[model samples]
Target: MDKKVAIVFWSKTGNTKLMANALKESIELQNYQADMFKAYNFDINKAMEYPIIALGCPAMGAETLEESEFLPMYNSIKSVLKDKKVFLFGSYSWGDGKWMRDWAYDAKNNGIILFREPIIAKDKPTDDILLKIKKVGIDLLSD
Candidate 1:
């Protein structure tokens, strides 16, 4: 079995990037190979080879994904994600996490199987938040 994961993210303030790193470390601790990539640099073709994918992008401009990079890359890979388990995570500095909610709804509607509910941090992740992020990676590998 292929024990690998792909983590693609875009972070303007680095919060989202931190979550990606946490996830990568957690997965690697379990003896799984986790590759990290910036949103614009990630290749969908390469991502298709993994059973698990972790996508992160902080909320931007009125509760939305980073339009230029993350959004476009996500849209391109979303359709093919139906058969794979995905973990959606990000950070938000304002609003009531509507972005994560809307994104989760869209992903579900598109037939993407969420590993769990989308996880979001208020600004930067606290130790608790990082623990949750790590747990997701552990759970995904166990699955």
Candidate 2:
């Protein structure tokens, strides 16, 4: 079977973008095709084309998902994402990563099959954070 992964994200200070790129590289290293897009540029209609979908967005004001673009796009594509191997990742500056937890909880409730635990970094990603993300990428498409 052809292995493909889609990475969609929104970044303000580029931290989340950095995470997205690292994930893409790692997945490619594993010889799987990985396509990436900024939240506004992603086409939700094509969501079903990939069995694995990774969504990234930094925690915004009040530690919520990026509202103007990311959240709306996520809301639209999430239904199609049910039964797909979904991964959630992002960067956060404050509030103890409540946003990611809440997001993951909601995804589980909505019947999305999460590939693994959500990854979160404070501000810019450290070497440790990047390494862990790379591992997640390497293992993402596997059982």
Candidate 3:
């Protein structure tokens, strides 16, 4: 079976993008095909081609998904995500990561199967956090 995973993300200060890159590297290290995309370049129609999807967006404006691009793209693809195995990760500068919690709740309510709880890091991810992020990628290939 093809075990391809898509890592889609939006980053303003390069923190979230760094996390996305780490995920892509980790997934690829496990010998799984992983594709990385910025939210603007990612076509939602292509989402279902992969068995697993990883989304990253930092907390923005009262701990919400980035409004301009990521939110719209996510909203557009959310309905199609039903029954899809997905994971969420991101970076935050403030406000206790309420955004990730809300996102996970919304995904669950929409019937998206979450591989695990959303992974969050404050500002730029530290080396330790990167390790956790990589583990999340490795876990995607677990049976």
TM-score of each: 0.97, 0.96, 0.95
Worst 10 residues of 2 by lDDT: 41-50
Relative to the true structure, candidate 1 reaches a TM of 0.97
* Maximum-lDDT candidate: 2
Q: What's model 3's overall lDDT?
A: 0.89
Candidate-wise lDDT, in order: 0.90, 0.91, 0.89
lDDT, candidate 3, at 105: 92
4-92 in candidate 1: lDDT tens per residue? 99998999999998899999999999898999989998767967888888899899999998899889999998877998889999999
Candidate 1 error regions (>4 Å)? none
Prediction RMSDs, each to the true structure = 0.8, 0.9, 1.0
Name model 3 segments beyond 4 Å from true: none
Give model 2's TM-score versus the native structure: 0.96
Task: For model 3, name the residue pairs that clash.
Answer: none
User: Which of the two candidates, 1 or 2, achieves a greater lDDT against the reference?
Assistant: 2
Q: Supply candidate 1's per-residue lDDT for 25.
A: 91
Q: Model 1: clashing residue pairs?
A: none
Query: What is the C-alpha local distance difference test score of candidate 2?
Result: 0.91
lDDT of 3 by residue, 3-90 (tens): 9998999999999999999999999998889998889877668886877899999999899999988998898888777756798999
List the candidate numbers ranked by lDDT, top first: 2, 1, 3
Position 139, candidate 2: lDDT:
88
